[model samples]
Target: MRLFLVIFAVIIISGCDDSNSKPSTKLSEQQSSSLLTIKDESVIPETEFSIVFTPNNEVEIIDAYIEGVDMYMGRIPLFFSRTNKQLQYIASGMVGVCSKNEMVWRIYLHYRKNGTQEGKIATLNFVVTNT
Candidate 1:
């Protein structure tokens, strides 16, 4: 009777552990679909450029870079709320003007969550006219 009771207790504890374990399979599926999509028109020189982030949610934006240059690395306020739903112009501070006549600037959007990279990086290319 003592042997049977010990075996039953071990089985019960193991079952509890299994229930507490995180579901890796489900988490992977969600992570694979997590992506950032920038839906804004191209930026023109001498004119203010407004970038809009769609489907704004709880995604933590690590940084926003333009043409390999850090625009809002740590100085500017980077937090975005869902109520706004748009990152307006002049909000991200000033960006350097393009010197070339026809320059193709690439905007990189980096995102993360809980200090871990959520595998979300979006790139948008825009031309900067000399005008």
Candidate 2:
């Protein structure tokens, strides 16, 4: 009888846990996309820059592609920062070679919430210049 009571108490306490409860405030679980751009006059090679992308809803980056001169020939490392809410990319040395040219980066983002299937492509444009 004591064992049965202890088991019942454990189950009751576990049931009171609210770890699976929904948040008090509702968060919109929609899919959306927006363009991220840099207004700098020049993007120096071998430098790292933070690219910010704001979506209408929370989303995670899927993949990225960059185009401009030979910028795509080499590996352009990308780091995702959730705290700062930005994506950091290292400019390849080819950027300076592509000076006076336009560099475009496309990022694929996906929103996975509320059983909704939504995706967005964020485009970023920058001008490679030597200052």
Candidate 3:
């Protein structure tokens, strides 16, 4: 009886440990999938993001105006391009909508070529990562 009880206890502890770790694994996976990586400020359809500057030529984002609570543009910029331009912002302060490791955000991209303005506001779902 004593041996049986000890085995049962060990099994219970192991089961609990496994259960607790499952959520963490799932969360990490979700986070990884949602992370957004901006390469050279280019927005592509799947992997990279790019801004459509002209019908034939597309340039990377160089600036952005994030919408605020009252639909106002944020004063400070959150993201930038290598050109040292304001290219993105965390509109809602990175909470709620961006609380989860994988979240969605409403963002704006500002890019231009020559004297033509060609960026627009858009919504993107990205996984927030430290890297």
Better of 1 and 3 by lDDT: 1
**lDDT preference between candidates 2 and 3, better one:** 2
Please write out the lDDT profile of model 3 over residues 1-131, one tens digit for every residue: 67545633432342211110000111123223221233333221112233211112334546653232322222223354342233332221221121122222234444444355754333333332211
Q: Compute each candidate's TM-score over C-alphas.
A: 0.44, 0.45, 0.26
lDDT of 1 by residue, 1-131 (tens): 67545633443342211111111111122344443323324443323434444423455666765541222121112233343434322123122343234444455556655455554655544444444
> Which parts of model 1 are misplaced by more than 4 Å?
1-47, 55-57, 68-82, 85-94, 113-117
lDDT of 2 by residue, 35-121 (tens): 343423344443444444445455566554344432443323344445454432222221213322333333223333224565544
lDDT of each: 0.38, 0.36, 0.29
| Clash count, one per candidate | 0, 0, 10
- Span of 10 residues, lowest total lDDT, candidate 3: 16-25
How would you order the candidates by lDDT, starting with the best? 1, 2, 3
Worst 10 residues of 2 by lDDT: 17-26
The candidate scoring highest on TM-score is: 2
Regions of model 2 farther than 4 Å from truth = 1-35, 39-41, 69-77, 84-96, 99-115
RMSD for each model, in Å, please?
Answer: 23.5, 21.9, 18.6
